[model samples]
Target: MQLNVERGAPATGKTIRLIQTARASGQDEHQIITGNAYKPADLELLVRHRISRGAKVICIDECSEQHIECLQRLGGRLPDELTIHAVVSY
Candidate 1:
């Protein structure tokens, strides 16, 4: 599932709803969770979701390529059996 948050609105509840809907529809099997740095805590929750679903983790950050690269590298190092993914904001 792909979620495109428009204008960075603080729709925390909406974001959670997106997650819930994705899970219910079996869209959480594989994902690339992306979010900006301003929502670090929320991004963490996305990571947890991917981990729980046994899906690969890919985080996208528009603020800092360095941070995104670092996160991708870290994701590459995880055990092959574990598919939890996370992208840390810059």
Candidate 2:
């Protein structure tokens, strides 16, 4: 499962929600790794790692259409082994 949040959006509760849900489900300390990237390579490792660990990948702070487009494109090409959730804020 992957989560992607758009820029300028309030993500105040997203991480908490995931943590709570994961804990309630009896999952171990859900490895929550949050980060940002202006380049594809910068996010590659983290994205792949999360996917490999069966963890959701989230993208936060996407403010521009170009950013959204890049994220969408990347999502489309990501390995089928992973699921992504994206929250875009206009």
Candidate 3:
């Protein structure tokens, strides 16, 4: 599992690069999510569900501090086999 946290300014093509990288990695299952689409708790639940469904990679675009905090809360709960990519823009 590889967790890639790409943090930088907006309009930097972070999301684009993330998707390209995930596709190039040949992962069978990858999901892309927008930060504002869900609250912290909801995001955690969604991630857990995806993990249970054998998702290999999960990408979060425009990721916020709340998103990071939520994932941090999951800590030991997150699957070791799943990779998370968070593209956060300031």
Candidate 4:
């Protein structure tokens, strides 16, 4: 899987723009999941579900270190075909 991390200060509209672009491109909103530093397990579950639903890319807004940890834990567990984009807000 390919992981792209976009980091910036909070309320910078990065997440919003990502959502808008995804929607404009006909991607399902469900494929984009909002996350935080505290919800690693939840994020993992959501990613798994999205992949099962045939989503090629999964977007996570407000990502954090915990989210990275979750991804690390899920390393090699998720399909290699998936692409993950994480928008991290400080």
**Winner by TM-score:** 3
Better of 1 and 2 by TM-score: 2
Least accurate 10 contiguous residues by lDDT in model 3:
22-31
Candidate 3, residue 50: Cα displacement in angstroms equals 0.7
| Candidate 4 per-residue lDDT over residues 1-90, each given as its tens digit | 878777888888897887875686578676577786337887888788878988777777778877977887786888888778788877
- Model 1, residue 5: displacement in angstroms? 22
Global lDDT of each model? 0.42, 0.48, 0.77, 0.78
lDDT of 3: 0.77
Better of 3 and 4 by TM-score: 3
Candidate structures ordered by TM-score, highest first: 3, 4, 2, 1
Give candidate 3's error at residue 37 in angstroms. 0.8
Candidate 1, superposed: residue stretches over 4 Å from native = 1-31, 63-90
* Cα TM-score per model: 0.33, 0.45, 0.83, 0.79
Give a tens-digit lDDT track for model 2, residues 1-89. Answer: 34345333466555455555555544444343333334545555566666667654343332245544565667666665554443334
**What is candidate 2's local distance difference test score?**
0.48
Query: Candidate 2 at 49: error in angstroms?
Result: 3.5
Better of 1 and 4 by TM-score: 4
> After superposing candidate 2, which stretches have Cα over 4 Å from the reference?
1-12, 24-30, 37-40, 52-70, 85-90
Q: How many angstroms is residue 29 displaced in model 4 relative to the true structure, after the best TM-score fit?
A: 4.4
